[model samples]
Target chain A: MKAIALKLCSVTGMKWGIPFVKLFSGEEVLEQLKEIWGTVGIPLIAIVTFLLIWHFGAKQIDTSLGQVPGPAMVWEQTKALWAEHVDERIKADEFYARQDARNAAKLAKNPNANIRVVDYTGKPTYIDQIFTSLKTVFMGFLIASLIALPIGIICGLSKKIMQALNPMIQVFKPVSPLAWLPIVTMIVSAVYVTNDGWLEKSFIISAITVSLCSLWATLINTALGVSSVNEDYINVAKVLQLSPTKKTFKIVLPATLPLIFTGLRISLGVGWMVLIAAEMLAQNPGLGKFVWDEFQNGSSQSLARIMVAVFTVGIIGFILDRIMVELQKLVSFDKKTIA
Target chain B: MALLELHNVSKGFGEGKYRTEVLKNINLSMEEGEFLAIVGFTGSGKTTLIKMISGLLSPDEGEILFRGNPVTGTSHERGVVFQNYSLLPWFTVYENVALAVNERYPDWTKETKDIHTRKYIEMVNLTPALNKRPAELSGGMRQRVSVARALAMNPEMLLMDEPLSALDALTRGTLQQEIINIWTKDKRTALLITNDVDEGILMADRIIPLTTGPNATLGPEFRIDIERPRDKTELNDNEEYKKTRNDIIEYLMDMGAEVKTKKTTNYRLPELKPIMPGKTFRKRKEEDKLKYF
Candidate 1:
């Protein structure tokens, strides 16, 4: 049972739980106590200290509108956001139910009656905006990965290809999402002419901007990873008389997966950050837009509400990074490769 | 026809001022079902020779013929066991072996491939480690998996490049005996590259020496002529084993000495005397006394 618990903790990247499990099992009590203090207790104490500092520091900092929101104020705003989301959900449900009932009645009264259900046009809540941001970032990250991986692999395999792409990659890599947004907006508007496409133009613009800003990380890391694969493994592939496709998928891919995952982790992070900035600039419907809207509102509670969005973005980014780490650990053969 | 032949084959690296002829005028041929071992010092182009034969590398000067046809790129017909175990780290022992089996016999059913993979893994005494990845296994165990993977391909010829060199003595002995047993069971054409004379003697029907490099070539061939099931302990006491061992060692030592002499550069040194620290301190003290006076 102790072993199982420890294994579960390790697998989930919750290594702090290991000492607790070991302590419970009555093995090396002193060492386990030290481990617990170092991993769990210290971090908890640090967080509490940070909160206390923030709580005090917030009272002194005054912006043009008001003072910065303390932790308590931010907490209150978080609850308020939840309450708003719940109320909006209930209203939406009621609207849909009423519309369905009226449509049914109309159909019953006249069998061939032409009745259309009106769509709910409610303002998106804080929670909805968060989901929207997540969706957009994922779309952007997916696009970036798709573009980066093949090119990266080819560049890794061939010296000539890598040489050709290196300069372009260097030039584009440092360009910010703010710079990309205008170009992407123009191109997306010009090329994507359909008004009733599956994706909105603003969403496409934000996603494309994110992809443009984020893809360089994945591309460079993947090429490095692919090129640095152990020569012995390549020789094994050769000795096996494997086809080029088989050699790549079977040998090269697996060998370079850890590095590829590192690249992906960076790409996803860049994509998320870029997506938010793009959304803010483009006034797209996401957390960035929500933040921008609250800033423009200039109400008493607006500062706290924006503070809520800040914490939400930070926590989500951390969670996304953790998710990538866990995914990398799952696929990587060596535990040491998890970084 | 010879099972495999290398005629006037030479390989070199770089060009112009930096050219290094790693292997030159390497000529060798192996008969069907014969086990040949090439014993060379480290950096003596042993690996280069084996790689050329396995078709992983091309010879610059001459052709390598397999069954009277010139060898081209790598083929499933020639399987190689590398010095460092090259089993994919992501794959378990079973998967590593299965990969070779699947590639070699693509027409075979999955069940047949699985059975074949398991059989070779069992041969290497790695059945218990079938689910273990290369990282989880010891050096010897990983090498065993590498051997299993190569054997599972069912190649007409096996090329092993110092496969047991990294292993501990006991593991090396065990693996050597296991390899000999497998070879005797179905005498496939096999080439073993090693720096160990005893290993070459124990495993091969004929042992050939590779000269020291910068332009290394094959030395004299020594037929083991020792009886099969050659016990390592008994070989120490055997007259023929001692004679053969002495001759090979002497030949290698002579070549080593010759290379050392040929490559040795004489440097002229300036004659100088060491200054005594105590004398220098006394001289400083005398000068201080004079200044005080």
Candidate 2:
């Protein structure tokens, strides 16, 4: 039973369930009971208490858009958003079916004619905006990692390189995504000109802004990781006469991986945050844009809808962090320190 | 020709006024298949000497030659067993040994490599902990793994830098026996740098003392004429063992005192006017009394 619990904890993100399993198995009942309470019961109770406060406190607050949304109002808006997504998906399916049918008829009439089916260019729902935000953040994070890791390694390996790059890193590290947004928008607009391209100009601008803002964390962390490699390991490599490339991959990379992953996690988080702000300011299609659009809408339902987006963003951010934690656990050799 | 030779090797750290000479005019050599031990105090340049032989460090004054060739940089020809074990924390014992074996014998078959890796691991008696990472192992066990890794490389020479110092007495004794047994079976040209006088006598064909630094150098060599399979229990009764141990200890003690005297006497106040020694002493005493009054 313990074995099963351990396996379950590792294979899935159900480590919180281990205490319950132990309690059921009658192993140190009092301690396990406390663990269960701490892991599960306490969080549930706190969430319930928060909802109660929000439900009551929402009644006293009033804005130009009417009362602030209570728990029920936000839930209603969440349901409405989900329902709108489902309705849009159904309309998209019909549009595709109609296009396919028309394309078939055209091909039947004249085999040589162009029968291209147009995409369903409908209004994106809340779910679509969430997906767009995720895609943009990941793209930016990937780009940031690719550029930062090599430069970081080189900087770590050589003091001369680090000295040369130090000024640039210091100058650019603290710049806000908002500051980058204008320059990125201008560059992307000037460079990415096409009526129907693989990616939109707004997306390229937002992604570039996210990369500019987020790359510093990864760069700094990776350099630190590389610099902090063990002297003994370096000696081992020297004695073994390991080629430079092999030394980096075999000894240096493994030694510094924990710090590198730490940098990546922070970079991913920074990228996610920067992406949202960029989307909102650029009026791009994402959760941030959805919130901005609702804020400008100025209806009674707008506040509730925006509240729904707020919860969505918080939950998604938490999930993204958890994913990075899991990745870190997989890569890190020092397991005792991770938790 | 000697397996390794160092000719008037000197090394120092820092530059100009801040410079501190750690090793000075140190000349030493080891014969092929001969075990040599260097005993010294902490900060006595023993580690620096070992690094020089291993080609991890370059001498400022002279060159080190291995098999008549001038040693340039670190090479697979010399395998080192470091004091701290230096195992990758992520790798298991088998993997750690295998990493070196793979590097040293890259063209060997997989089966041959695995067998070779296992043979040395078995030599160190770490088969039970073969799957365990360094973090999981005790200090003694980690050292054993390092020993196994160095041996598995099949290098022409083995260099150990205080490898048993971190272990407790019991583990250290056991590892010493294991090292002797391994050396007896295959006589690799080996050099051990240790601070322990007893360990040096027990392990090496000859034990050399290193003077304390600000410019440290080898003092004298004491050849251990003890027979093979030297028993720890009977070592107390052996006259030669006692004599070697006492001679090394006495030399180290005298070296310590000599360094202290040298430090005080070597300070030359050349700018001050020379005076009669007794007169100056009286004058300083009178000056002290006047200041107090």
Question: Top TM-score: which candidate number?
Answer: 1
Q: Write the per-residue lDDT of candidate 1 for residues B1-293, one digit (tens) a residue.
A: 88998899999989999999999999998999999999888899999998898888899999999999999989888989999888898888898988889888999998888888899999999999889988889999999898888888889999999999999999999999999999999998899999888898888999999999989999889999999989999999989888998888888878877886776555444665646997899779756533321
lDDT of 2 by residue, A77-161 (tens): 9999999999999999999999999999998999998978688999998899999999989888988999999999999998899
Off-target runs (Cα >4 Å) in candidate 2 are A1-17, A36-57, A91-121, B15-19, B106-115, B127-132, B254-293
| Whole-model lDDT, model 1 | 0.90
Worst 10 residues of 2 chain A by lDDT: A6-15
lDDT of 1 by residue, A33-130 (tens): 99999999999999999999999999998988788888998899899999999999999999999999999999999989999978899999998999
Report model 2's chain A TM-score. 0.92
Segments of candidate 1 deviating more than 4 angstroms: A1-8, A24-26, A94-116, B109-115, B261-293
| RMSD list, candidates in order | 8.5, 8.1
The 0-to-1 C-alpha lDDT of every candidate, in the order given, reads 0.90, 0.88
**What's the CA error at residue A58 for candidate 2, in Å?**
3.7
What DockQ was computed for model 2? Answer: 0.63
